[model samples]
Target: MSNHELGTVQVYTGNGKGKTTASLGLALRALGHNFRVCVIQFMKGSSEYGEYKALEKFENATVHLMGRDTFVNKEAPEVEDVELAQEGYEKARESMISGKYDIVILDEVNVALDFHLIEVEQVLELMDIKPKNVELVLTGRNADKEVVKRADLVSEIKEVKHHFQKGIPSRKGVEH
Candidate 1:
């Protein structure tokens, strides 16, 4: 078994970018230390992301992509979107309790919760039941207040300015 210390719930949320990036950075750090890591991405199905390709190279890391490549409609999400989010949640819960992973990153899970693809109560319960040794990281915008309250560390990445404001489209390897 890994010798990592007890893990705490960390929430990275805001209207700005870098929530996923921050969690992935943590994943990379954990992997560098030879810790088992599981990343279950909610509302993100495309394998084209650069992080997916990079993380795949690590034998100790498992990345599960959940959702379609298309954007989810926040006002009226498709039934399939909901299904995928639920599946992702189940996978995350299992990963946390299985004792196989030292770090579990639920990518875009906050967005999933905000869009009503998954219930806040469910996420709260998952936090409660998380194994003491497994670090749980939740990322995305519009994080619920309750989640923020319960998290051991909350980082709000506010966007003071972004390239998108300058009419610059998402650049390859930078935004993606």
Candidate 2:
């Protein structure tokens, strides 16, 4: 079924492991119904991610990688990092306004904002201009308070326990 009728602002944020996973699950559900989905991943540039590889098979899904593989210096990000984030933000704006997507996911945008790679005002403006028929999903830790206040749904996935504490590295299929 076409999902042109869908619309809502959803946020997945917190210090948990499943924020991106949750959003990807939503994308999978939408794609199953033949909805057009756009994912703009901020602060993540690896093409080796499992979701990236998996989503490549969906004709209705588009994923944009917008950062270097190296971690951005939160206190003083590189010029390239800033540039990529801006590019990603512009792409997200275009996707939302183009009316070509049923769902748009800004993965890790909250962290982009937290790291000062993008301004919170710009994100707020994007929210203001979102078409009534477009569904927006923002995923990352440290979501801005204003964003949370404006969202139609906000899910905070707090980390109760994780294997990372045991010094286990990210697994291939599970984390990447």
**lDDT of each residue in 20-80, candidate 1, tens digit only:** 9999999998899999999999998999999999999999999999999999999999999
Model 2: what TM-score? 0.97
Could you tell me the lDDT of residue 30 within candidate 1?
89
lDDT values of the candidates?
0.94, 0.94
lDDT of 1 at 71: 96
The C-alpha local distance difference test score for the whole of candidate 1 amounts to: 0.94
Candidate 2 global CA lDDT score: 0.94
Candidate 1 Cα deviation (angstroms), residue 71? 0.6
Model 2 C-alpha lDDT per residue in residues 13-94, reported as the tens digit of each score? 9998999999999999999999999999999899999999999999999999999999999989999999999999999999
Q: Estimated TM-score per prediction?
A: 0.98, 0.97
Q: So what's the TM-score on candidate 1?
A: 0.98
Per-residue error at 39 for model 2, in Å? 0.3
